[model samples]
Structures are given as structure tokens and as C-alpha cells.
Target chain A: MTLSITDVTKRYKIRVTRAQVNALNGVTIDLPAKKTLGIVGESGCGKSTLARMIVGLEQPSSGTVTWNGEPIFDKARNMLSSKHSNIQLVFQDPYSSLNPRQKIGDSIAEVLTVHHLVEKDAVQARIAELLTEVGISPELAHRYPHQLSGGQRQRVSIARALASQPDLLVLDEPVSALDVSVRAEVMNLLIDLRERLGLTYIFISHDLSMIRHISDQIAVMYLGKIVESGPWDSVLENPQHPYTKALIAAMPDHTEVGNNAYEAPLKGEVPDPASMPTGCAFHLRCPIAVPSCSTNAQTLREIEPNHQIACQEVK
Target chain B: MSKPLIEISNLTVSTTDDNRTLVNDVSFSIAPGEAVGVVGESGSGKTLTALSLLGLLPRGVHATSGSITYGGKDLLTADRETLRSIRGNEIAMIYQDPMTALNPVMKLGAQLIEVIQSHGGDTSNAMERVLTAFSEVGIPDPKRAYESYPHEFSGGMRQRVMIAMALILSPQLLIADEPTTALDVTIQQQILALVMQERRKRNMSMLWITHDLGVVANLVDRVIVMYAGRIVEVGSVKEVFTNPQHPYTAGLLASLPKASDKNRTRLLSIPGIPPKPWTVGESCAFSPRCSKADQQCRSSLPVLATNTHTDAACFHLMGDNS
Candidate 1:
């Protein structure tokens, strides 16, 4: 079973201004079973849009996203097909994701009931099993979302996602909203669960350190495009794209803190997607851009084995 | 060292309604041109400590006992007029979100000019000063940026504008509470560089409050670790990062996912949640979550004592002694 996203593009129309924003432009990726694919980018980089498309929450303007050679979206019905339940999305803010008035157990049981994953009589036992799998106490099932701490609430969210018995979990900045001490525990839980359940993950975050820690393959995105993609070690340690290099250099690592030779590599913020710069999307901020960069469009091309970059300057 | 730029002694902040202690007996000092980083998780009272220096505590919160002395003047006891004069002129602050800090309807340049005029600065040359400040912070098109509204600028540009406004007077001290936390790493580095450059140019002192240890390691000279409203550890960056004494501090540093680690092992997370402000008793507040907590740590409060590398409030210290 493999997940393939081929030439996907998403566009959003502004109601008041009637302007279109090109969120994702021609992004492609193939993830083998049980492998973690880390997608990283700054704000407005269209990572969230791609994640939404993959989970069938939103359909792409163009191209196809398939799981096990079956399209997740049903074009005729204008809704996600039955196979979409195999993929679940865990959002960034746990506080807003869970229903405020709902009990934690009921929230998980809702998924189980909707999917008909278990018998009605077995729903309570399944909820307890799900809670324990995520390292939450089964007794807290009666507690409301507000009664639980941020970390516990996130665990409940995970348990709710697990209640569907998903094979691929699209975690969108799962630990970003968490406190520093609690982030580690949640991350460890995710890693442990992934190993035990043989689950594949599409982890999305702006944090490169967290990405580096959890990812098997990594893709770096800029304005509406994947600038680089490769094995995690190769992409991180020996990056080809200037944007990828800038991100790695900009990360605040304690190991490099003692070295006073540090410098900010990137120059400017991400430009508006509606009015993207001509040629390379990153040419305006690229430190190594030539005059021709402004006129030449760049596309992802294999620079080495399993490594691809979208840049005209690199040999 | 030349007279300390700012000294905060025995500061205690609490709620007016319940009198629940938020910040307790926090004391530290920053020398001129030194950058000090205050690090802790949420509800650690790091922001309350910084806010007390400027008398900007929220409506329900009040500092009951503390002395925030700057240049021999206690800001806590100072009159409104005295504080008004000292606020933007001698001391400045920048927050995590520039959008909330800035006026959305006003043009960026006019807002900056307003800050200048409020500090009794020359209004005639205010536009030029604003443009110069914008360029100094590395805003690409200052003329266009000057005419734009706050909503027109990106998050990074908005932050640069905030820094420009804060440093227009070349204040002697700057207090930044998670100024770069809302930004991406690429933009965060730019803001950090810009602030450090301006600080060096003016020989300014700074108190940087953040939960990110990596930022503290990169930017600040000294660090103060806080937990449940009290200081847990204080020392130079080299001393503390190399040899953390307090268990909480050690746990925090260990919790981070380092790029340097060759093995991707499980993080050593601190066991339990932080205690509520009202629940904190006479004993060490971190005792409940601490792996090394003992009978003494739970029965009685520990005061900051000189360790080999840093001053830590812990019965069981790590590093050299351990």
C-alpha cells in the first residue's frame, strides 16, 4: 500500500476581493507503507492545504491523490469516499479541535460508531484500549476537554484519531501548541504508537528540529512549491536548495550557539501567494540567484539518487 | 562591574482577588550591555516578572513586594509621571505578536512617529528618523513600507517595525517577551540578528523572556531558569548550559530534541505537570515533578545556594557535585 500525490494544485478564492490565491502548485510525492514523510515550510507555504487535500477535507483544483491506487475523493458525489476513513488528520490546536461539551470517551466512541469499526457492545472497551494506547488514563474518559491539561487533551485527540483505526495519520504541527516539557512526551508517544501499530505518518511542521527527529523522508516547501525532497539525512546534512540551507542554518541549535560565526542566511519573508515573484518563487530572497533567475521557471529535478531540488543555480 | 543597569530584588506578584502568588521572591540583576534570558514553561511567571519592571501587570495582578531599581530609582514606587517619562525613553518593550502591539488602522510610519512624539522627541524630523530606523532593521523598501498599514506587512516585517519603534529612542534597556516565538525560524533569525545588532550599537541591556532553550543558548550571555513563580537556577550561559544544577533545569535541557544527537532516542521528559500557583506550598514547587525530589525537598523550601557553576535552589544538584 502506497500513497501518491501527483501534480496537485489548490487555489482559494477571496470572497470580498474576488481574487485567487494559488496555494499549492504542482506538488508530487510518493510515500511507501509505514514510512514517515515530513513536510516542512513557513506560514503561507501551502503545507496545510496539501494536508487537507490528502485527508479529503478539501479537493485539489487539479491532479490526483490516491491511497492504494484508489482516489480518496469521489468527484460525482462531491465528498470523500469510504476509503478516506483510513486517513485521519490531527490538527495543531488541541484546544479548539475537541468539542468543548463532549466527554473524552464519547468523542472517541463517536468515531468508532460512525465507522462501525466495532460492535455497539464493544465500544466502551475499545475506547479504553484507545486511551491506554496513547498513554492516557482510561478513567479520564468522563472528563470534559477543558478539564484536561493541554498535553492530555492532545492525547485524547490522538485517541479519537486512533478510534477510526487509521493507517496514515496526517499530524499538522501536533506538538507546536504544546509546552516544551510536554512536547517531548507527546512526541515519544507518537513514535511509540507508530512503531507498535505499523502506521505511516505525514508529519507537517515549521520546526526543522522536530522534523529531523521524526522523519524518514523530508520535503522542504516554499511559496506553493516543494523546493527540495530527499532522504532525511541527505536533505538535512547536505542540502542543495538555498531555501533548505537557509532553514537549516537559521535553526537555533545549542551545539552551534558557542560558535560566533553564525549568520542569518535568508534575507526576506515569503511573498504573497497571489502575487508570486516571476521565475523561481524564492529568487527574490535567494542569495545565489543570477539575473536569469528572474525569467526562468524552476521545477523539481533529480540532483542525485533519491534527492531532488528546484533551483536553476545549482549545477 | 560598572553599576548594574537594573536590579530586581525580592519581587512577589499576586492576584488582587484571591491573593494567589504568581511570582515569588524573584531576584536578579542585569549589567549594562548584558543580555539575560529568562526561560520557563507556561505559568512559570516569566512574563509577570518582566512586566513588573515596567508596572504593566494586568488589571487583576499586582506586585505586592518588590524593588525594581534602575539607576538608583525604584520603578515600583515611582509616580505615574516618573514612570511615563522612563517607560519609552529609558526602557522599551516588544511583545510576541506585533499585530496586537501595533495599531492596525494607522500607517506604519505615522505610528512610529507617534512613539517618537510621545517621548518628547523632535516631531519635525520624525519621518526621516522612522525611515532610518526601518532601514536599520533591514526592511527592504522603507519608502513603500512607511506608507503601508500594519496589515500590509508580513509577520517578519511587522516584527521589524515593532523593533524599530522600540529602539527609536536608543533606550538604555529593552525587555522582549517572546518577540520571535510567533515567527518562523528563517524570520526569527532575522529578528534576532536585527535586535542583537541594535543592542551592540547602543550598548543596551536586555531581558529576553522565552521558553526556547536554543534561543537562550544562541543569544543571551546569562540565563535565569524559573519554575512555578520562583527562580530555580541562575548563571552565565556557559556555566548553566554546560553544567545545569537544578533538576528542573536539567530536565528542561534534556527534553529538547537536539540536531547534534546522532541517536534519535526518547526524550527525558519531566514526569508530571506543573503545580497551580495556589497549590504551591512552602516546599519547592517543582518537587512534585522532579525526579530527584526527597523528603526535605517536599517538606521545606530551598533557597538559592552557590553551586560549583550556578546558584540553584535544589536539595539534589546535578553535574560536578552529583
Candidate 2:
């Protein structure tokens, strides 16, 4: 396995001068090498938090995250980055990620400069190489982030991400802000880079359709936990978790309107994470919710040969 | 659907910045209760087309020529007071970001009530209308939410409140300019659900402007593909998705990430980038990316023409001459 997350739980002290919000509850997952894994959930569902923890951006309150058979966070060291460049995160907003005042070439070169990977004389060539790798023109090197279109800017951000040539990539909704035409370009670029570089990725996004398109393995997240995990086709075709099914049903086809797309619509908004409901966190919106669903919590159990689901009723 | 509710005939909306034309001779019409989607890259002028209809152009922007007829009245030549009357009353708009559109200091109820009182013809039932609109658009706690400030609500809820405010007047037409772009997929699904539910109930015409073809394929009845201030293709959503006439539209549709695209490989992309709006966009605006562009396409702009029911702006489309 490339990465393994064991019995992870996260809770943030969101004291808004009034009350606290419990962002993440308990979660566990395992991701294999040279593969793409997708995490799908509503916003504030702790999906991003799970990603943050894996990249050491946030420490798990009580859990362990292993990378390549080693404990990455050094739970003993407080998960602080004391110069471990093994993992890197590509954020959602390309517009904000790159500095407006800085030139595109300088922005990308800074990564290599900071990582101490190349000689000062070779920085310009490295920047141009990174830009070409992401399909950006060399002439755009002098332009600022604001001068580039949304798609071009995202390409620059990707180039910056690749500057370090890190082992594992953590992409957080990289193409969700782009237009449909540009979205495909960026997604294709990521897939191409992964193959060429032999990279491992933890792709986090709410666009299940796109996730389903690229992920080798799929992990359905809900309320800060992996409710279901398996092969892409298996999880998509026969989603034992109700949340997974609801998410699949909610996806609108590239050609039809909304009202007809879903037969059993997801009901009620996502409950605030701070005060999660008792038992299964997803029971409130589950179409097949039962009496025991709210009284007993379920753990991930191997229901099929390669699939795991966290509901007792599914097995 | 007997008569068109909105029509744009040779609409050329220009800006004062060096007399730059933002929407060039754009023309289309929306039938009563029909849904039309406008799509393009970032600078396609789709938003400007929507803004032009409502007379809500940013400061200094002016329409150089063309007619904007809504409900059989000329919205282009209409007086400021008349334009004011048409806005928010006949053509309500929901922007992409509701947080920036709403008043952070005011309660949801007061903002919605203000909209109702302004265009809804009365103040007595305004509160009732606000609550009814809130509940209608899927806000869970109408009473409590009405009293809460904008900051108290979630992003999706705030957008719902914004939708409620925009739709409370039951405008003849609704203009949603990427209303769900800032929202997550699930919440966007919900918002689109609510919008469609309300549309079905009211049979209101809609002008949905967005850059996501995947969304329009599912939401709109027809499609209008825009490029650098001009429309390239217009057709029923079915025709556009199944067999798009314009090369740009086809490229865009092929580029959407599909749930069923298994064995993932390099997604098909139209190489190069969309042209800048200035400099008249010599030849076709998409010649920079189109694989089919020839000598004629590089020198002159193609006129938009209608064949059967579908309309396309291309010198090479189906080898048609207009």
C-alpha cells in the first residue's frame, strides 16, 4: 500500500463566540500505489480535513497516517513540517495560489529555488521545462497570474506543483473553478502527468462524475469517515452506502434537466458537523435509513471481494 | 410557447473603453416559459448578453445598435424608469455569488420583503410572501432564517435566500448568471432542483448563463454557444449534445469530464486558447483552436445562419452558405 489511514478522527474547536462545531468524527482508509483515489462529499463534510491530515497540513486528533510503510506525521513530532518534501498539496484556487505581482516564471522557479533542487543558473530552464510540461507556452513566462486566463493560470499552478517532483500529490478541487472546455484540459493534464511521472494522488473533489472518470480506487467520504471503498466500477454500479448512491443519483448528465435525473432525491441539508447526529452520521439523508441506523454506528466491513462498506445492513 | 417572451435582434452592446464592442450583433429569442443556455469561455460575453437584456450594464457601457424586445416592448430604447420597472420585476437575476449580492447587515426577511414591496405591488402580504418564497425554494426553517443575518446562513442557504428574493416577484423571466458556479456540486444540484421546481410551477422563461456544458446539457431546453461577443451555435439541447453543429460547441461538450469515461486517458481538448475580444477576432474567433479552419476562415468572420431548426455561425458547417 502507498498510504494507509488508520482509525482517524478529527475535531476542530470552532468556537464562534457562541458554540463549537465538530468538523470530523472518526475515519479510516487505505490507498494503494500508482493509483488515483477520489473522496466525494458535501462541503464541510470533513473531506478537505481528511485531505489536510494526509498531507500533514492538519494532525489527526487520534489516528495514524502512514506513507510508503512509514508513519509520516511522527505523531511524536506533532505533524509539523520540519522540511519533509515527500508530499505536496495543490490547492483549489489557482487565482489565489499564484502571486499577482510575481511573474509566472518566477512563481514556478520559486518552488525549485526553495527546495534547493537546481543551481541558480538552471532555474530559468527548469521554469520553462515545467511550463512546457503543463502545456503552457514559453512566452507566458513573463506574464503575471492575473494576465493568464483561468485555465492557463491553473496550468501554471500545476507547473509549480510539479517543480519539486514530489512522490505523492494531493489535489484539492483543482479544476472545479474552470469552464467545461478548460476543465477537461486540466483533468487530462493531471492524468497525463501522473502516468509520465509514475505519481500517486489523493484527488479530493465533490464532482463525482469527474472523480469516477479518473480514480482507480474510490473512497466515499461522509461526516469525516470513509463510508465505502472499492474499485471505481463496483462502488459506482452497486453502491452499498446510501450516501454514495445519493451522490451518484444527484449527478446531472451532460445532456438532461434536474427534476428527472433523480428518483429518490437527497432530503434535508447536511447537518452541521459540530453537533453530529447520533449513530450513522449519514442516516438523516439515507434513502434506506432504518430504525437501527440512528441507534448503532457501523464500521467498515468487507462485504464483497474487494469492496468495503460501513453499514451493517448492507452486508 | 406561442410568442417569444424575449428577443435580441442584431444587438451590439459596446463599452466606452476605446469603443470596444462587448456583444456584437447577437440575436436570439426566448419563447414563453422556455429555457435557453448561453455558453463560452471566460471572455465569451455570455454575462454581458444577460446584463444587456436587463439594462444592468456596468457604468459607462452603452449599446451601439440592435433591438432588445421583451414582452413586445423595446427594452433597448426603453426609458430609465421603464428599464427600472423591467428589472427585478419582469427579469429577475440571480448572480453566481449570493454573499456579495445580499446585504450582510440586513435580515433575510427584510431583504426579501424589500424586493416584494418594490415590484410585488403591495406591502401587506410582503412578509407572508417572503416566508412562502423561502419555504418554496427549500429553505428548511423559513421563520427562523428570515430573522437571521446573511452571515448566519451557510453558502447554499444564502444562495437559496438570494433565489427566494429574486423569485418572490414572480418575474416573467429569470436570468441566472452562473448562480451555482461558486456552489459545490451537491448544493448546486439542490439549487438547480429548486430553480427547476419553481420554473415548472411558474412556467417562467429562463436565461441560464454558464460555462459548464455538462450543466446546460441537463438544465436547458436549448443552447446558445457564444464566443468573443458573438454566438457561434444555437440549437435544442438534444441536438447540441447528440450532434453539435458548431465545432466549438462540439469541442466544449467533448471536453466535459464524464462519470462514465472509464480507462481514463488524455481528455480531448481544443488546442490553443480562445481569442481576445479586441482586434475584431479576425476570421472565426475559434480559428486559433479549430482544426478545420482554412484560408477563408482566417480572413473573414462567419455569419450566423439557420438551417432547419438549428443555427450555426460557420463558413464550413454542413457546407452551408448564408
Model number with the top lDDT: 1
Q: List the TM values for chain B, per candidate.
A: 0.98, 0.95
Q: Assess candidate 2 and give its lDDT.
A: 0.81
lDDT of each: 0.90, 0.81
Per-residue alpha-carbon lDDT of candidate 1 for residues B213-271, written as tens digits (9 for 90 to 100): 88878788899999999999999887788789998888888888888786777888887
Q: List, residue by residue over A1-315, the lDDT tens digit for candidate 2.
A: 478888887766755655555566667767777888888877777888877787777777887888877776664254232433677788888988889999999988777877677899999998889999999988899998888888899999888888877778889988887766778888888888999988899888888877887888888887777789899889998888888887887776774532234232676777777778889888887778799989898788888887999887774
lDDT of 1 by residue, A1-315 (tens): 999999999988989888789899999999998999999999999999989888888888999999889786653133333432788899999989999999999999888876678899999999999999999889999999999989999999999988778899999999999999999999999999999999999999999999999999999999889999999999998999999999998888865554433467887788889888989989999999999999998999999899999998999
Per-chain TM-score of chain B, candidate 1? 0.98
The per-residue C-alpha lDDT of model 2 at residue A107 equals 88
True-structure lDDT of candidate 1: 0.90
DockQ of 2: 0.51
The TM-score of predicted model 1 comes to 0.97
Off by over 4 Å in 1: A16-18, A75-84, A260-262
Q: How many residue pairs of model 1 clash at the backbone? A: 0
